[model samples]
Target: MKFYFFNAPAPASLEVFRQEYVSQNLKKLRLAAYLAMSVSCGIIMLPLVFPVLNQTRHATFYRGLNISLIFSSALALGFEHVLTKGTRKQPPYWVGQLLCLGFAFAFICSCLGITFIAQSNPKNTLTMYLLGLGTVAFLWDFDYLETLVLVALTSLAFTLVVQLSFLSPEQALLNHCMSFVILVCFYFLSRIMYSYRANHFLQLKEIEEKNLEIQKMSQAKSEILGVVAHDLRSPFNNIEMITSLLQKKNLTPEQEQQYLGLILTSCQTSRNTINELLYLAREEQLEAIPLERLDICELLQQVQQEWQSQLQGSKDLKLLHPPAPLYAQLNKDRFHRIMDNLLSNAVKFTPANGKILIRVREEKKKLQLEVTDEGIGIPERIRPLLFERFSKARRRGLQGEKSTGLGLSICRQLVEQHGGSIDVESEERKGTTFHITLPAVK
Candidate 1:
């Protein structure tokens, strides 16, 4: 049963749309109320200019009805004003309904008063009622059912009043038929108004959702740029330092060769970083990485050798792992990124000649790895936020090395995405250790 008479929203969005619809219509409601007030005031002043009321025996009663109409309109306006004074949240649904129905009642009362005064001129009376019906149609928003109720009540009230009070039977019958026809015409008009308003709200809602999605994408772009800039800085700095060292005149052939090798390693690292950034930017959600069952101890040994070579004897890098190979399901590249970030942090903070240890073991179906460095330890206050992006805990290294603070955060994200967890332990000035736990392949 698909009835198009009511332009209703989907059920999931219905409640939200209702609130927004009411909020948006508040100004229109106020304007319609003002128009009702103006009409009432105009009719109230008519007795002063025209002597028609003086000829009527019920002048006092007619005067009273016009005054009551003005009062009701003002009351409705004041109530709406009070409700919408300082808030953006829409009032309850009944509140909007009450305002609409009240204003409709006021408009009908004004029509009745005018009809009574112009009864002697049947043509004028019919014209006044038709205009009133049209005004009700254009002034407010209501779905088909409410409009039907409004039209039915208005027509019946007009028919009963005309037949009982002023007109002869035949004249009243003619008036009744004409008013019903006018109301039926306006019923369709009211539906068009309702449909347009509802459709416009839906368009605006769609635009709003699109704007939110665009904002999220823009934010993601900024984050990727920040990450690329941060990670590339260290390797680029290493290349610059090694190149400067190689340029000095007092160096031995061995020293020059070592410095050139260091520069080459730094360049390779920078290229790897750029490749990783490209892969991340292309895959925003970091879709599943192809995993392999491999010996965890062998991977750690390879990383240890790489770092030992990069350190160039400045730090004593040692590995302590079980003699037997421990296996885990791992994404090789992502696992390398985690180790790189952790070791980079250790090397930066650890003073020259300090000891850095990589410990790996398997216990109770879990593989555990730890990197402990005798560096300037993390402050207690900083430990909690150490893994947060752009953390305030980031500080200069022992040799005044700069930090972007995003490394640890990236490490934690990579570890968690691989079904592993990372934690840190540190004390100011003594040492710091990072621990990682991953499921072991039995």
Candidate 2:
């Protein structure tokens, strides 16, 4: 709709459409020029072939005109070939315009020349002129203004030629009227053709974009299915095998307890995997999340206390924030989940007595939250995949704890859904710091 115009095309669209139109029509123009050259050659030889046409009063003049047409057509053909050599991309605007105008004028001149030589046969001359005009209109793709200019010039040329050659004033006047009417019809025909081509081009572009989108969706679906199948299979197999072992008569009480423990762990793993898959699915659906203004400093302190107690003094958890309340629009439960995942990772990686810090502040009218830990930092090689689902960077924690490889991914999804960004800074064996930035409530 933006591209559609009642009178003229928009400046940008016009340039693009013009380039395409010109590129496509260039070959046709070249072929037409070649045909013109060949026809002129034949006409030049007509006197020799028929022998009787040589005796006509204007025979010399006709031969001279045909010679000129042949020369001009050959020149045009050579110029076109040289201009278009190795031009695979769209030619420049001026070049295309020059080509179109050059061919147009050449055709017009040839038509008028023929009419002048064949004055005695006025009807046949007029028919040839009309055919030439129709071919010119149909072959070139021109806008309304260009078409109008070309048609007007053609009409004037036709009328002038008829006035100079015809003996009867009445017949000449009739020819002028017919030329005017015919040129008008050609103008509309040319416009209709241009519009059809434009519409067809736009339709092709739209279909291409839709096809690309569909391909991306299909690829993502395949990836999600692959990850789900791979992650779920191991746990399910462990549970099944453990249950079978427990049912065996040779198993002692200790073995039975150990097998039951293995089954329980497998079940827990399966449940965690399912929960993560649900998180990814929910994020993909983009369900609306409710938000409320809350003091972020107070919330961080509460989270610090919760994680600190869980650490039980094996690791020191600290909270640093501004004295004043800094408010932000946040979904409380999702925000809590983000903090829990970060803190859980921090605790799991940080060795005994290593410290964890939760920092909250306002920067440039935005809420900034950072979670830094004195733990083995991520490897440079794996950092790129750290936030990806089913990440290859996933490994056991310092305490030999398991990882679902989905916590950071879910945190990123939740933060982005709240119109925020999450990023990490880390150096191997030094430490890691995560920064979360969100819009602040003033």
Candidate 3:
């Protein structure tokens, strides 16, 4: 469904092929159609002016030809309007392409039809009119095949006109040569524009892609400075409090060890968060740090156990898995954060008597893990950007606790780095399910 004018990438679908092939240069296409009509009108009517300006033999015939050209242009213009409306109102894709080509076809017919209405003598009027329409074609975004077809149509039209009309041998040969030169001119003209448009579309697409990246980078900066500020500041406060305690002269040995351990854990946690922020700053992707084989079902079991203690007054939380361990290669720490984020959201949202299920399965060589919670689901308005970085994460938990939006966003990055994907299904007031897919080890 693609033709090489200057050789660009093929369209992804038939409709896409129609769009790129036809509408990419829509403005030029419109201009060509209008120009062809406007000038053809003048050429057709020029014979009527010849009677007043100079000697004219076939006065009645020229007048009739002029009237026909005017009528044809009007009819073609009407088709143009219908095609334009049909294209916009969601008609079939082919309809627009065909109508656009209809303009060219009308131009060819009228150009030849004029010959039958002209004086039976040698004059370059027909040649000029045909060539004028051809010139208009050059301004359009026709592919090489389209241009070749147009050239053939013009050649055939001129041949018919020559055989049917009265012309000297000299004039006939001259028109043929002129037509050859003009067709070649259309060839090079179409090629130049074809390449220009390809490059033009390519650069525009790249700019759009880069613009998205820049927006993400901007959002990451705001997150690091605004959302992560609390996480960073809380750890620093813990370190300061431990430092203050250390300054007391008579602290017991066990107490001192516990304080030091608390300080170490806080510092490590802060360091991990800072590392993720730095990774976001320096590169677009989080480098997949070395991974070890871990049993995913055991991982979920540990997560459920941790949540049981964390959510003491909460609803029933269950882990469902097969007897055989499902293993995958993953960075343990990052994997823990991914599961913990999803689990924490489920725990935070579920009511005291509601149910939550973390299920795991294997399908088509991929591992599927889904966390389903019967709690207040995501709002319809905010669902689209749930995993977008820098999007406000202001949803209230069952207990009215607010969340920092960065968790799900970070989880997405971590999952992608592991060659996995995450998604959520939710309905207002019904519940939410977070789904994860990853390559599984045999």
The lowest-lDDT stretch of 10 consecutive residues in candidate 3 is 8-17
Q: Of the candidates shown, which would achieve the greatest lDDT relative to the real structure?
A: 2
In model 1, the clashing pairs are none
Can you write out model 3's per-residue Cα lDDT over 1-442, one digit (the tens) per residue?
2234645455543234446656533445466556655765676667466646335555566556556655665665576566566555543555555555555655666655555435454554456455556655555556556667766877787777776665668887876777677667766766676566656665666688899989977866766787577767887899999999999989999999999998998888687667656654543554556778889999889888988787784678899999999989888778888988888788778888789999999899899999999988999889888897655645767776545565688788888888899999999789999999999996
Question: By TM-score, is 2 or 3 better?
Answer: 3
Query: Each prediction's Cα lDDT score?
Result: 0.77, 0.80, 0.71
- Candidate achieving the largest TM-score: 3
Candidate 1 positional error at 184, Å: 3.5
Task: Give the Cα-based TM-score of candidate 2 against the true structure.
Answer: 0.64
Give the Cα error of residue 406 in candidate 3, in Å.
2.9
lDDT of 1: 0.77
> Total backbone clashes of model 1?
0
Order of all candidates by TM-score, from best down to worst?
3, 2, 1
Q: What digit string (tens of lDDT, one per residue) describes model 2 on residues 1-442?
A: 3222225555766676777887777788788878888888888888778999888888787777777777777777776776688566666767776777667766876777677655567665567677777887778877777777787778777767776685477777777777777787777777777777777776776688799989977876776677668767888898888887777899999999888898888888788888877777777777678889998888887887887788789998889998999998888888999999999898889889999999988999898899999999988899899888767788899977777788898899899878899999998788899999999997
Q: Which regions of candidate 1 deviate over 4 angstroms?
A: 1-4, 11-17, 49-53, 56-61, 86-89, 116-126, 165-177, 208-234, 247-276, 283-442
